[model samples]
Target: VAIMGRNKKTLDEAKSKLGNGAVAHQGDVTKFDDLDALYAKVDDKLGKIDVLVVNAGGLTAAPFDQVDEAIFDSMSDLNFKGAFFTIQKALPFLNDGASIILIASIAQSLGFPGMSVYGATKAAVRSLSRTLSAELADRGIRVNTISPGPVETPIYGRIGVPESQIDGMKDQFREKPLLKRFGEASEIGTVAVFLASSDSSFIVGEEIIVDGGIVNI
Candidate 1:
């Protein structure tokens, strides 16, 4: 297993938790040079890729009226452009039957406050999956997306939520899902694993929503 991130410390920590089989590559997905280096390292260390997950992104929240040019560009650069180039750069290194899983979000389907730019970027990713699947079908490579809801992760804290209001925010998120709880990180990982495996061979160009009925119910 190989992981890439812009932060060395967090990358190292995740790599340690992933065990000895996992390797960490420090690179920013937004930079083409960095992506090239990452795939080069992957080819040198592990050979052709079997599974490619374009999962590097973050949430930047602001009302449409208050969103500045910097915010707009930042969201587009990290979420949309980064995902596009990551897959493009990996083409040569990907095996013929490789699985490509893009991490979208339920935000793409719903209108949430302060998420206009963020949501639009995710929507673009979902669209990319459909088009790419058709383009790569001749090569036997499957491209799909997983749109997760409110998963339990450190993302909330990183998003500038006040400490005192964090629990309240979580409560609101829990209520959005019919399951009445936040999704575990492991649950999302399980879905990704299934998509990566041959079990989902026929499930191409589809977005498997793992949102606990938030979108459907």
Candidate 2:
């Protein structure tokens, strides 16, 4: 497995946890040149990429009236443009039957306050996954998305809210979810693993929601 992100310590920790099966690289998702360099290193070491998970994205929440052009552009540039380019740059290194899993959010379909720009970017990702699946079908590469809801990660703390307010927001999220709890990163990781493996061989261009039934009901 090859991991790409800005957090070198986190990536190193993940690599240690995965033992010898993982390789860690520090790169920004927003830069195609950085990704290309990482891809080159991976190719030299791993030969080819069999699975590409475009999972780098963040939420920038603000009231619609307060959202400025720079804010919207930053969110879209990182979430959609970065994701699109990651796949594009990895195409040459990807094996024919490679699986490409894009990480999206249930916010894309759900009406949530202070999430319009973030949700729009996720919606674009979902749309791209479907279109790319069809476009890459002839090459036997499958493109799909896992739209997760309220996963308990560092992102929750960075939702443009005070730390004091996060617990209350989390409580409300749990109550609203049918499962009565926020999802774990591992849950989304499991879905991603399945999508990247032959277990989901017949599935393509589908947005699998691992949202604890928050969006379905």
Candidate 3:
């Protein structure tokens, strides 16, 4: 396993926790050249990539009128453009029957007031999963997406809402979900593991929504 990110500290921690099975490379997903270099290094060491989880993303929430071009472009470029190219560039290095899992979001299908741009980017990711799955079918590469809602990640603090307003936003979902709680990152990770393994070999171009029934209701 290889971890890609701009944060050296986080990468170091991942390297330590994942041990010999993991290698840490500092690179930005949006930059194809950087990703290419990382892939080169990994290929030189590991020979071939059997699984890829395009898990890098960001979220920016603001009123439609308040969203600026810079903000919209930043989110779209990182979430959509970055993710699309990451898979495209990794094609040569991926094994013949590799599994590719994209981390998407339930917001892609729902209209959350301030999440328009963020949701649009995630929607693009979901679409990319289907199209890429078809494109890579001849090679037996499996492409699928996992959509999680209200995951308890540090990202929620960066939702462009006032710190004081975040608790209220989180509280609103408590009773609305069938699970009656937010999801943990580990929950998403487990779904990703299944998708990456042969257990999900027959699944392709599918979006498994693990949102605690948020969108189902």
Clashing pairs in 2: none
Q: Which ten residues in a row have the lowest lDDT in candidate 2?
A: 156-165
lDDT scores for all predictions? 0.91, 0.90, 0.91
For residues 1-97, write the lDDT of model 1, one tens digit per residue.
9999988999999998999878799989998999999999889988999999999899877778989999899889999999999999999999999
lDDT of 2 by residue, 1-217 (tens): 8888898899889899989967789989897789988999999888988999999998888889999998899899899999999999999999999999999999899878888999999999999999999999999999999999888788877778777777877887899878999899999999999999899999999999998888878
lDDT of 2 at 77: 88
Better of 1 and 3 by TM-score: 3
The residue-by-residue lDDT of candidate 3 on 86-140, one tens digit each, is 9988999999999999998888999988988999999999999999999999999
RMSD of each: 1.3, 1.1, 0.9
After superposition, the stretches of candidate 1 with alpha carbons farther than 4 Å from their true spots are 161-166
- Misplaced by over 4 Å in model 2 are none
